[model samples]
Target: MTSKYEIRLNSKIDIRRIYTNETLPLRKKVLKPFLTEEECINPGDDLTSTYHFGLFQENKLISISTFIQEGHPDFLSTFPYRLRGMATDTEFQGQGLGGILLQHGVEYLRQKECDFLWFNARIKAFPFYEKLGFSYYGPLFDIKDIGPHKVMYKILIPK
Candidate 1:
């Protein structure tokens, strides 16, 4: 079931204009790990501090990830913590595009001298993040609409 799709590090990507139709498919894919459709959409609607990446197939937007900056406010992180939209089109799942986006984000984070990278990973996806060297911190937290999530973080060793 191979399809013509590609994942690239897109700097010009924007989250704001993504139409619901284009965004919905990826949301469905993420439901396995992130059950809240609204969490996927909220950051896109009002992006205060986030970076964007796009997944495309022949010029069509198929998936997106949003990296939100997080850290102690007084500390003002050199490396921003991120919460990813991490949605892939139903047709594009299991093709390793999510890893591509995550790698790309880490490269950028590395350049910024980030001390840590964190995300609320769904229980099903904990192993995925673990493969990336992110360790779980604290107990799982419940989202009113999305069930439980494990907080995972990777401490970036200085290069």
Candidate 2:
């Protein structure tokens, strides 16, 4: 199944709150092909505080991410949140939609006065997260068969 690409580079992509299940398609196609769709459902996804954010272009969900209220063992914060299951549709990669999605999702944490956000980012996407002001710490690590990953986090400010 493929989504039709009807939006141009300058078009505004809609970033919206989505349900946990809505993230499975992109998660399966981009991040977890080795696992079944049912397996793509990440742990804690159904938790009351867990949130899913999706990027839509031409009404097609092109990028998705999951956020949970969890803290990094080495990082201390009042309300530490973790981001996971981030995937951008291959066709929509390099279009800056991922950053836009992050900016939108960060607002949620900002509203809740979260102290920081952290995630294990794939090494290849380290620069992308860096561009969004996230700092990488610790050494590169592997997530099972998912290649190299490193811990990244950003401090949040509440207004």
Candidate with top lDDT is 2
Q: Flag regions of model 2 displaced more than 4 Å.
A: 1-12
Q: lDDT tens string, model 1, 86-154? A: 666667667766666676667666666777777778887776677777887788888676678977777
Where does candidate 2 have its weakest 10-residue lDDT segment? 1-10
Residues 29-118, model 2: lDDT tens digits: 999899988899978999988888888887889998789999999988998889999899999999888888887778777887888999
Instruction: Give the TM-score (vs. native) of candidate 1.
Output: 0.67
Best by TM-score: 2
lDDT of 2 at 115: 80
Instruction: Candidate 2: give the clashing pairs.
Output: none
Error of 2 at 15 (Å): 1.6
Residue clash pairs of candidate 1 = none
